[model samples]
Target: MNSFDKLYYENYHKVYRVALKMSGNAQNAMDIVQEVFLSLFDKLENGGEIIYPGTWLYKVTVNKCCDGLRKQMRFATLDVAAGNEFHEVTIEKQETRQIIEKALFELHPRERVIMVLYSEGFSYKEISEASGVKFQSVGKTISRILEKLEKKLKGLNNDLY
Candidate 1:
């Protein structure tokens, strides 16, 4: 196999899992994965070299997720403007995963992506590279996000986090 095929095979699962976690749905994850690989194919076709393929894929996946969320937000705004009443029903009794899912869904798209990357054991430097946040600021930003998550989650289950 050529080098591009080899890299795609080696990295596809990693990128997909990150996208899945970021998107919270398999359909969106698959779309983001396809988009990322399609972009990669174009880069390789144009004789462009990616120094860190994994990091680049992560960056692209997160950006695509953010784009999707932004589109959803815009649609929601338009729906509200059209006089549609959107009611979100909350579960009274929730499992740990459900609670965490709700908390993650409440976060802004950028924060949600960073939290997923961090939970997957991406280093601060790697997150900075993928997220385009200043390298030095990743820790502080993560700290704040974590505190927010903790505060929200602790109410659901004190021992589970």
Candidate 2:
């Protein structure tokens, strides 16, 4: 297989999933995945160096997702607009999802990206590489971010029910 094909085979699934979780929607995730691969192909054709394919893919994915979120914040989010889609789920689970979505939307794009990466089980080093945050800061930053999520969730729960 060609190098681009090989890279696509190895990383496409992961890139799509990371985009999905980060954007909280299928369409946006797919768009980001497409853009990422297209950019990668362009870079490859232009003879740009790619020392670490996985890291580069993830970092680009994160940046694309962050850009989408920032633009989304300027308008509104898919989660907010699509709230009725969750009506078929159990109320408890739906409520939990709503609270989590609220918390995620409240976070700055950087924090949201880091939290998504952490939730996807990426190590601190991987998250730092993807996010450009310091490796030493990932733990402390994530700790604080989780605490913020928890606090927001608790507040949402109390306010809602």
Candidate 3:
């Protein structure tokens, strides 16, 4: 396999998972991943060098996901203004995974990306680089996000009781 092919094989799943978490839609995630790789391909085709391909892929993926989410939010708002009634689809029994996902989705897109990257075992510096957060603030932001999630999960659990 070629170098580009090897790079894709190594990073495809990681980028896809991050995209999926950020966008919360498989189709959107796939599209974002495709866009990111295409960007890398273009850069390489032009003889541009990337010292850290993984970090570059992650930054691009996060930016694309954020853009897509912003567009989606705008459409959702327009739909609401057009008298569309949003319906909440409740699972019969909320599994732990479902509950966690629910809370995660409630967070702002940037917060969600930061939390997801952290969970994926990216170091603070990696998360900062990927998510466009400052390195110094990644830890504090994470702590804040964790507290918010904790409260949200607690509230959700209480609702079930």
The best candidate by lDDT is 2
lDDT of 2 by residue, 1-161 (tens): 99999999999999998888788777888999999999999999999999999999999999988888777665235445355676677777776777778778678889988988888899999999999999999999999998898888888787554
Task: Quote the positional error of residue 28 for candidate 3 in Å.
Answer: 1.5
Structure candidate 1, residue pairs in collision: none
Worst 10 residues of 3 by lDDT: 75-84
RMSD of each: 7.6, 2.9, 6.5
Q: Write down the lDDT of every candidate, Cα atoms only.
A: 0.81, 0.86, 0.82
- Residue 24 Cα positional deviation in candidate 1, in Å, after optimal superposition: 0.9
Candidate 1 residues 1-161, lDDT tens each?
98789988998899989877777677778888999999999999999999999888889888988898888873111111111222333233334556677778878888988898998898999999999989999999999998998999998678774
Q: Highest TM-score: which candidate?
A: 2
Per-candidate TM equals 0.81, 0.86, 0.82
Q: Which residue pairs of candidate 2 clash?
A: none
